[model samples]
Target: MRNFEVNGINCVNCANSIKNALSDEFGEIVVDLEKNPRVVSLNIDDKDLQKFTDELDDLGFKLIREI
Candidate 1:
């Protein structure tokens, strides 16, 4: 699994939105809104990270970094 800091995911709705959007393509996703910097943990490969970033970008969010 990889941990990513997400920007613009400010609430439960946002977290859910991301989870729903990503779940189909990237299985077993976890969104932790309570964490500092807001984290999204997933089992996606590095090559697919950019695709994930793009999907998040479309939803008005960003995968800021892997931590």
Candidate 2:
């Protein structure tokens, strides 16, 4: 799994949208809007990271960094 700090996630609905968007492609997605840095965790192969980033970007959210 990878942890990514995200921005522009305003509410639970936004978080749920993101989770739904990526759920099919990447299993076990966790969107923690209540976290200090607002993190998203997912279990996906490294090769798919860019695609995941793109998907998030298209959803009007930015993935700040991976940890």
Candidate 3:
């Protein structure tokens, strides 16, 4: 799983919004709300990483870094 620490995920609703918005194209998305910056994890090819992050940005999530 590729995990990305991101901002703008304040609550469960935000997490769900991310999952709902990207899951279909990006596959299952796991958001860890317990973390300080929050985490969004999913399986994706390296070639698609940029696209994935871009999509997240389009949905109002900003990537801090990938883990």
The C-alpha RMSD in Å for every predicted model, in order, reads 0.8, 1.0, 0.7
Best by TM-score: 3
Q: How displaced is residue 41 in candidate 1, in Å?
A: 0.4
Return the TM-score for candidate 1, rounded to 2 decimals: 0.92
- Model 3 C-alpha lDDT per residue in residues 1-67, reported as the tens digit of each score: 9888999999999999988888999899999999989988899999989998898899898999987
Query: How displaced is residue 21 in candidate 2, in Å?
Result: 1.1
lDDT of 2 by residue, 6-63 (tens): 9988889988999888899888889887785689998878799999999999999999
TM-score of 2: 0.91
Candidate 2's error at 60, in angstroms? Answer: 0.5
Off by over 4 Å in 2: none
**Where in model 1 is the C-alpha error above 4 Å?**
none
Give the local distance difference test score of model 1: 0.89
User: Which of 2 and 3 is the better model by TM-score?
Assistant: 3
Best by lDDT: 3
* Local lDDT at 22 for model 1: 80
